[model samples]
Target: MTSRLKRTLLALSLAISLPAGAANYSIGTGSQSGTYYPLGGMLAKVWSDNIENFNMRAEVTAASVENIIKVSSGQQLVGIAMGDSVASAIQGQAPFRKPLDVAVLFALYPNVVQFIVPADSSINTIADLKGKKISVGAPGSGTRVGSTAILEALGIHQGDFKAQSLNYTATTNALANGQIDAGVIIGSAGVGAITELALTRDIRILSFSQAELAKVHAALPAYSGMEIPAETYSKVTAFTAPAVWNVLVVKKDLDPALATQMLETAFGNMDKISKVIADAKNATVDNMDKLQGVPLHASSQAFLTKMKGQ
Candidate 1:
């Protein structure tokens, strides 16, 4: 074969082997029992089913902190995290020794700081937590960081409140067994565990009223104010609480086309996701700006902005 013809044929063959320009991606989410896991699975299904060349898959791995490590290592194309946690990852704040390379796609919704006590415990306020055994949050999860910060801000340090780093399920069990004074979980109000616990026992979501939220934001400016809707859980009739945004994060260097395709699919099929997890109904183009933790990915920003304009 002539050299020129051979080169042309090789190029054609390579192009043929490719998926006509589709970029498959994976999203790293949290544990199976947590909200992130199911949400990730739904996104993956919608993306693979609708977006061309986008065969996205979701992995139920460790939450935020570990997600940052996975995405930075190029092992995952996307991740879900609390906005504050994202700030810590990129800025190399506590829990992370060095900065990471990650960017934001969009903000889904608020992940509130929920501390469920036994409903009969003596602890009634943040101050009441003093010298009491509290499950701050799961290790490496964003809740842990917020729990620590809130406690410290209230003048309750590690010594002030006994810290037990436990996941939502474990902490739930502990709270019911009277083994722990309080359990901390950072997620949307009516989150699986928190909602169920509320149904079984009267649980109250600790409020960091205007004064308390102000104190917290002063230290970690990344938190954007959030309001927990009325009657989010079964037992509780109404409670509006302050919270931070939970964001969809991705590797900074991801292919632009893939990012665009993924966002297109996600916003396109949000209704389907809403069926499984009703809270996801809030995931829309308008709310995406809530993710200021990292700069918006160009492709996602463009798609979402254009959708907003329409």
Candidate 2:
């Protein structure tokens, strides 16, 4: 064949083999040690593998607040955010300048609030945290937002305690080194940081009193009381704590059809995801009821309606 014809043939072959208009997307997740990160990675893999001409990756982020901002700005295609953060953002609450255009794809799982302190510490209850140094997660993390709300609801205002904004790993380290008196972590039941800390040092998971939980619920209706099963972490017993369901969200302008495809792909592969992230087992069509306050993506509403019918 002529050299020019050979080049033409090569170009045509490449076109035939590669997907037309292939697109790359990213899912914004939390710290490397958090549940969101691994869940995001699993999603990226399954979505990329199942979707034609689409590539997806999981980006490590500061979690909910940052994820919401980045997803709204189109920096990331999707994000996992706590329901409380989503509600606050939608209402143009603090840390967000104005209501952002974001919609939920589906509910993931409940992020249980875990109050960690040295096992033998004198801090016995939420009220005892007064005047104590506490790590309430990173500045842009949902843990920070939710923990603050919880503390304030119980009359433990910022000035009432020395509040520190640190990520999960940092919070764990600070606790181990006696840098903080207590740390508030809102994550999946088997959160790596808390689990690792429990293994190396004796730690306690504090529970809320009925009145305290009632106060929190009255102040922030988005939070619900839940239990962290015994043995979920070593050296810890079952305890009741506040929890907020985590939701997968996409930007408002994302294509409806694409959103539908993504949801279908994820729900269809729940078995595979659950194998990797135990919390994923709770990510089901039935749990769609858990997602509240946030507007559902048009595609998600339709898809969920169709699934519930079947």
Candidate 3:
């Protein structure tokens, strides 16, 4: 063959052997402006940079439920799930029609359920929220599910309160503007949105007593035991509230090697990620095995095993 033709043929063969963009995998995150989306974007950037031949991307999904479904179907490679919700998704529990093959990449930080009442409001407890206007978080969010569950545990139904399906920003605004009596938020202990609201306006966290947690935990085994430490939020100087875990989930059948790399990347970058979100500072190798109810994927388990050994 002519020298030019031989060179052209060789280039074509090399190109054909290459797989798709190594740094181009999609992560299904939550609402456009929420923690999950930005967090996912951050992970995509970090992991894409750290891992070789595998880039990452992010998609705004309907938080937990939709993300799990999409991940299970392989529509999205990664998802951020509330621990309880992830467990339910794996077990095919409520809100999910059937059992799904969801696996944990690794555990993220806590998604604390904060019950907020006006600073001067008399609604100090969950029971007091009855007949009060409340923002129970955005539609299809983990907050919504947890709020609904919390209300149920407190023997308070949706109808009992003026349920507003608003996002954290909206909820903070609505509460500040007196549009709602209480706002139920599911986020990190040091959530930016929550802190911003607390700066000027005095707020107190509605502490969940043991009985309340008992009922909630009974129905949701996936929830991890948590406490909002004293001074964690200025709004609650010494608040002690129950919290839940968050999980990095994936399709059960995703390539194990890819999953391992992702999990390692997540935990390895724990400090950097924690800076992106307040609760994440606590994310470490120690927490990788603590998904509560959601089971870890084989690849993730293998990584955790190595992490533990090290």
lDDT by residue for model 2 over 1-310, one digit each (tens)?
8999999999999778667798888999999999999999999999999999898899999999999999999999999999999988888998899999998888999999999999999999899999999999898999999999899999989999999989999999999999999998999888898989999999889999889889999988988899778888996888999998999978877898889889889999999999989999999988875866778888888887898899
Tell me the TM-score of each prediction against the true structure.
Answer: 0.87, 0.93, 0.86
Ranking by lDDT: 2, 1, 3
Displacement of the residue 261 alpha carbon in candidate 1, Å:
0.8
Residue ranges of candidate 3 with Cα displaced over 4 Å: 1-20, 32-34
**Residue-by-residue lDDT tens digits, candidate 1, 153-230:** 657789877899888888887887789888888887778887777777776666666777777777777664566665
Query: Which consecutive 10 residues in model 3 have the weakest lDDT in total?
Result: 16-25
| lDDT winner, 1 or 3 | 1
The ten-residue window of minimal lDDT in model 1 covers 234-243
Model 2 TM-score relative to the real fold? 0.93
RMSD of 2: 4.7
Using TM-score, give the best candidate's number.
2
True lDDT of residue 65, candidate 1 = 84
lDDT of model number 3: 0.78
